[model samples]
Target: MKPASKSPSLKCLFLVAALAVWPLPAALAQPQGESFSGYLQTVAAKARREGISETAITRTLSGLTPNQRVIELDSAQPGSQGGPPPMAPYIARHVGPSIVSRGRGRHAELSGVIRKVEARYGVPGPVLLAIWGHETNYGSYVGDFDLARSLATLAWEGRRRDLFEGELIALLKMVDRGVPSYKLKGSWAGAFGYPQFLPSVYLRLAVDGDGDGHADIFSSPSDTLASIANYFRDAGWRQGQPWGVRASVPSGFNVGAYSTRLTAPRCERVHERHSRWKSVSEWRALGVAPMAPIGGDVLASLFQPDGPGTPAYLLTGNYRVILQYNCSNYYALSVGLLADEIAR
Candidate 1:
């Protein structure tokens, strides 16, 4: 449930990625005639089958042109793109002092709202704030891409048409449900609001935290915080537990024996990087121990992002929940570490 942001966000923010706004084909551009128009018609018909009103479709989706930039970004994805660097360097950059400092400040400013959300959702304030800071820089830069256009363009490009088309239908549904076209601005890939819920995610989990009758994540910081917490709560964030803690893996430890055999459909590669589920006590018996606080007996898995020499982690189920938000080990680790610093 992450979105593309004006800036990079942590919650699967990197998981979702972003697009560009470059010029499309001279003739196929401008939401009008030719293949682009035909594609719109095809999607609009599908939307009709899905129960979107014709009027709403005509108003929001007619004459749409493909975005070349969205295509470029979508093509340049993680494995497709040159892939990211090692875990430690990426984590260090993502959870640096500036982000942590801003997160702490935002935490203080929204202390009242954080407390309220935690009271209602059983999610800690620091975790939510860290997500906020990572996604859209505490709402300072939630991208300016026209969501309809971005999703539409990605759909037309046809790389991952089924996925983008579904998102397009959801955005049209949002328009039908009275979300203004103007407010539908977000990441080039269709993540919106301070917390960056996709259109579908918004429909399922967005809440009215500000008591304003509207779950206005775009304008209401209160709602954004609550929505983020609610997302984690639904994603299985433990109420009174830390996400995970650093651990030391003994030299020459048999990593292959503990490797995960189960494969998750979503983020399969990310899940593949983790070790099999083992309780903290089991990990301790195997010569792995936490550097920070973690309860014994919790189900955890081993992860050594930088091979044998670098730091290792005994990631808990809550860490798995963080991955549900984005599904990247680096992203999940950064979020946990950032929340730690904010609380400090």
Candidate 2:
């Protein structure tokens, strides 16, 4: 047997040199490196040792160029000044008559699959429909980036290496398990299919609702709904409870005393919009009544998304479950409101 060749010591040295001499625009250039070729070969060898097939490796990596846009977007976190528009403005723009009309139409079209999903998962069909509407605008805009290429590029960039590396590996595993590369396209951030699931999420929660061998979220509404239901179930969705309801806040309601003293474990921004958890009875005593009736023994929290003076809400645990989807109060609230509308 041949002795193993000693690995090169200064792997990053050439990269550093390339960065120093290369102009900014040139650095953003397409694939152009014999040195990078060596690195990739070494990586391929390691992957092969770990049981990844040569064919899979070659196919997964063929024609991959470092995506400059991904690098730029990953580095540029949205600043406070340039952050998303306020809730009202954003709602006006995105949740208007046209969107609602289209959503209602889609809701009618997918009613059968939605009903089956809801029956199986105990989540309301309209609620799932509302989320589908909000996330991808009823499948009208599910992004257009190649999931593997984007994730691989982000993984190799070394800035958010840990995060994207995991996603890249998951993407490879997805291919290895038989998801066609052509069907693996999604958002620039690697969120894919009708429900915009991350690669890890797809592995864990994707379902073949139509009883086919594969979970085709890209094209199958049944699979998409089932996958979403599975996601919500995994995220602790409670059966037979309302997520939340809009309510009128009474006069002289003390906003100061209603604030949460502790931070939530996840989706802090969404939870921050809510007051500390209190029983529905306590809330009712404080002149907060649900605009819609809630049945059975449902534990609820009080929330005023636009502070105390505006409309308040009585939120159940299911509302927090919705937060797991997007981690935004506006998103959860909109889903709830839209579901109510659709149900009505």
Misplaced by over 4 Å in model 2 are 1-25, 29-50, 80-85
Candidate 1 per-residue lDDT, tens place, 111-153, comes to: 9988899999999999998888888888899988888889988
In candidate 1, stretches whose alpha carbon ends up further than 4 angstroms from where it belongs are: 1-34, 80-84
Cα displacement (Å) at residue 59, model 2 = 0.9
In angstroms, how far off is 87's CA in candidate 2?
2.3
lDDT of 2: 0.73
Give one digit per residue, the lDDT tens place, for model 2 in 117-212.
Answer: 888988887777778788888777888888877877666666566787667666766776778988888888889888998887888889999998
Clashes of each: 6, 0
TM-score top scorer: 1
lDDT of each: 0.80, 0.73
